[model samples]
Target: MYLFRLAMASLANRRFTALLTVFAIALSVCLLLAVERVRTEARASFASTISGTDLIVGARSGSINLLLYSVFRIGNATNNIRWDSFEHFAHSPRVKWAIPMSLGDSHRGYRVMGTSAAYFEHYHYGRGQALQLAQGRAFASDPFEVVLGAEVADALKYRLGEQIVLAHGVATVSLVKHDDKPFTVVGILQRTGTPVDRTLHISLGGMQALHIDWKAGMPAQGAGRISAEQTRSMDLTPQAITAFMLGLNSKIATFTVQREINEFRGEPLLAILPGVALQELWSLMGTAEKALFVVSLFVVITGLIGMLTAILTSLNERRREMAILRSVGARPWHIASLLVLEAFALAFSGVLLGTLLLYAGIAGAQGYVQANYGLYLPLALPSRYEWTLLGAILAAALLMGCVPAWRAYRQSLADGLSIRL
Candidate 1:
């Protein structure tokens, strides 16, 4: 305890340099921890993007491609499955529930998804959590009503009862739009930290109504244009849809139902287990994630190296101090122990400051990140792994402190009572 107080007093005498070293280490530690937290949370978020569904059925395509378009909403589908084929499997005894998805429309930059009321009751994410409305109610029999995702509503400043037009394609700016058949926003879903938060949802009937007047890829001619009200009286059953998700009555029957959907004679359909597909997708991104972690680790090492340099550089100027202590009954080991204590002090202070900085950053940016990127960064306590990381950092600092400690011990022994300067 006496040695520790002596070491702290010595550091206080050089407080400017000591503070800089602590700040450097704190920044590096903060960065490393931040990267690790984001990597872990992102993986968890990715895996939980869609859950409680046994299989996802779509037109035959690469599993990654299908998963991308269906769950992540990343790209367009190669082909859409016939709605009748969806009905064929949806009615099977093995199937418990199905949610059809009709994509390929956009509101502003957000992709528009056409689904059924069943979607609200069936679709789930993040540990089987169902979608909740932040405002108003789901689109009920009205074919001209739409639902906005939390992100879409917040970014575009939309409210319930507001009229909005959907474009023909997924482009940010489309020359062709369903302006003549604008729909009223009936609801806005709560944020899910998934692709769903970036989507604009509408019933399948509303989807069909938006494109009902189109001929080929272009809008119908002036006389052929179908009014929104006129289409309300017409059959709005979707002809085809991008993809659909299914839940099985029995987990044991999952493979059986998947096989049946893939082998359906009605169309070339593909069915994949959501869990398996999510794993495959995460594997593809693992390399980049590891690279980021490595970069942050290197930054921490750089900061520690700076600390080692500072200590070694100060040893020359403090040689007289060491010699004086040696003459005044202090053992060489005491001098070495003092140096070790100083290093530990700097590292421990950095760890504390880094933790504070991390929490502060998370508290400040939590809402903005969730609103814009659909990633929820929680301000929870550090996990066991994070504690292990911090322990390793302090251990590494102790190991590094040994180098300067040895140098100071040799110098104090050699220059017993002599002042070089």
Candidate 2:
């Protein structure tokens, strides 16, 4: 007990150095926990984005690329699936419903997705959950009505009845705008923490109406832009769509239906299972993930190295203190134990403090993240891997503490009653 008091007093004496060491360890702990949280949440978000949808059909391309473009909105599709292909798949006996997606436009930075009301009816995420509107209503009767994702509404500060113009193509700045045919925001969706939160939903006819006067990727030479009121007279039919999400009548016949769609002679298309495509994507990205983990490990090692150097540098000053304790009848083993205990206590406090900081950040940013990205930042209990990693960190700290403690023990024995500097 006396030796413990001596160790505590010793640490309290050099408050500045101890605080610095604690902070370094805390920062390393923060990095490790943050990386673990991000990696887990990223996989969770990806998995939840396409849940309950059995298959996705798109133009002929790599399954991973098609999934990345259609599901993640990360890339562009190479080709468009013809309208006839969508109809064929929709009417097939095995298919319950199909949601055709037309991309290539944006309102500000938000993506404009043209689809029917069927999208809000069938889309699911995060444990087979369905879409729910948070405010206003769906585009039931109004062709020009639009629905805003939580992110789009929050980021742009748009509300019901606000009118906005869609830009030509997906460029950040567009020379051509559909200012002539603006759409009204009639609905706002709840936060889902998926790409859906970042999307602008409009009717298929609205998309067609916007591009009516354009041909060959530009306005027709002799065509004058039509007014919003005059658009009612023009034919608004979509000729192509980027991709389609398919719901099957039965999960058992999913492969048979997929085969039918893939072998369809009416149009060229490919059907990919969302789970399989996501697996392929992760596999392709595995090298980068592994590299990141390796980097985090190196950071931890560098921190531990810093910790050791700090302890060794401070040992000289502590030697006189140790000699005083020895003169007061404290054993050499007791002195070594004090050094080890100090190291262990600093490491434990650092880890605990770091975890609290991480949770606080996640708690504060939870709403913003869900509203903007549709990712639910839950502050649940620590995962199994987190516990395991924490245990490993504690064990490593103990090992680091032992090195200095052992050296101090040897020196106390050699010096006996004499003081060594």
Candidate 3:
């Protein structure tokens, strides 16, 4: 205990060098913990992107593919499910709500989603949080009105009542545009740190109206023009939708509904539980995650090695000081314990500072992170695994302490006091 105080006092005497060693360890610990925290939060945010839905029904395809396109907006669907099929299940007595989704349109590179007002009412993200309007109201019966996601609205500088045209296809640089069918920004959604924040929402009718004049993906020449007023009267019912999310009144019926959707005679379809599909998706990415973690672990190891080197090098210079303690009745084991205590002090300080640094970085950059990657990294204490890692580092530091401590133990009473040229 006295040796611990003496060791800290000794380090304070060489504060400059001590601080440099601590700095190296601190940065390494910071990076290690940062990677772990981000990785964990990313997994959580990714899985939570769309929850409170028992199953995501889409045209028959791999669950991973369906999740990628429907939830992540990463790719296109193989085929669309008929609106009639969607409606049939949507009206099931067991169903609490359903939000039909139609894709294949883009606005300024952001994906445009066609859905009903039920989306604003039933869709949930990040633990069942309902979609909230940040600026204006949700799109109502108006076929030409649009709702912008927070990121989409902010990135494009769109305001309520701003008019924007959607490209014919999902391509960001589509050559064909719906110049005649511009949509008004009726609402802007609160940031959810999900794909929704980058999407453009519109009524399913709006999607149908946008292409009412096009035939086979091209504007039909000599075709009867359908103005917005005319579109109001025309059938806006969606022919086919990319996917639909369903919330059941009773979760016990999840399997029953999913089975019914899969066995439907109307069309080939697949029903995937979000939690199960997410786990399957993670299996594909698990290797890469482990690789990143291993790399961070090595960085922490290298930093500890550097701290070890600094302590060992400083031991020789402190031999004379050690001899002074010997003269003051300090035992050989006391010198050893003193050396060990200093290493422990440095490691503990570094770990403490590193943990703080991680939270500070997350607090400062989480907004940018969410806006860019749509992943929310919450500010929180070190997780169980992170605490385990810190414990390992301290254990390593204590072990590394023994190396220099042993060398100090070998110093003779007369040898440490005598100087050799």
Q: Is candidate 2 or 3 superior in lDDT?
A: 3
Q: What TM-score goes with each of the models?
A: 0.93, 0.92, 0.87
Q: Scored by CA lDDT, what does every candidate get?
A: 0.91, 0.82, 0.88
Clashing pairs in 2: 193-374, 193-375
Which candidate should be chosen as best, given lDDT against the real structure? 1
Give the alpha carbon lDDT tens digit for every residue of 1-421 in model 2.
7666766777788788878887887878877887788778878888788788989999988898889778777678989988888998888888898998988888886788889889999999889899999998887655577899888898889999998888887766888777667889999999888898888888888887777778778865435776667776667778888999999989999899888878888877789999998888887776787788778867766776677777778877667766777788777788778878878777887788878888998999887776545567689878999899888888888889888888788776336445644
Candidate closer to the true structure by lDDT (higher is better), 1 or 3:
1
Model 1, 323-399: lDDT tens digits are 88888889889999999999999999998999999999999998788766668889899999999999999999998
TM-score (C-alpha, index-matched) for candidate 2: 0.92
lDDT assessment of candidate 2: 0.82
lDDT over C-alpha atoms for residue 403 of model 3: 95
Model 1: per-residue Cα lDDT at residue 13:
98
Residue 320, model 2, lDDT: 70
What is residue 145's positional error in candidate 3, in angstroms? Answer: 1.1
RMSD of each: 2.1, 2.3, 3.1
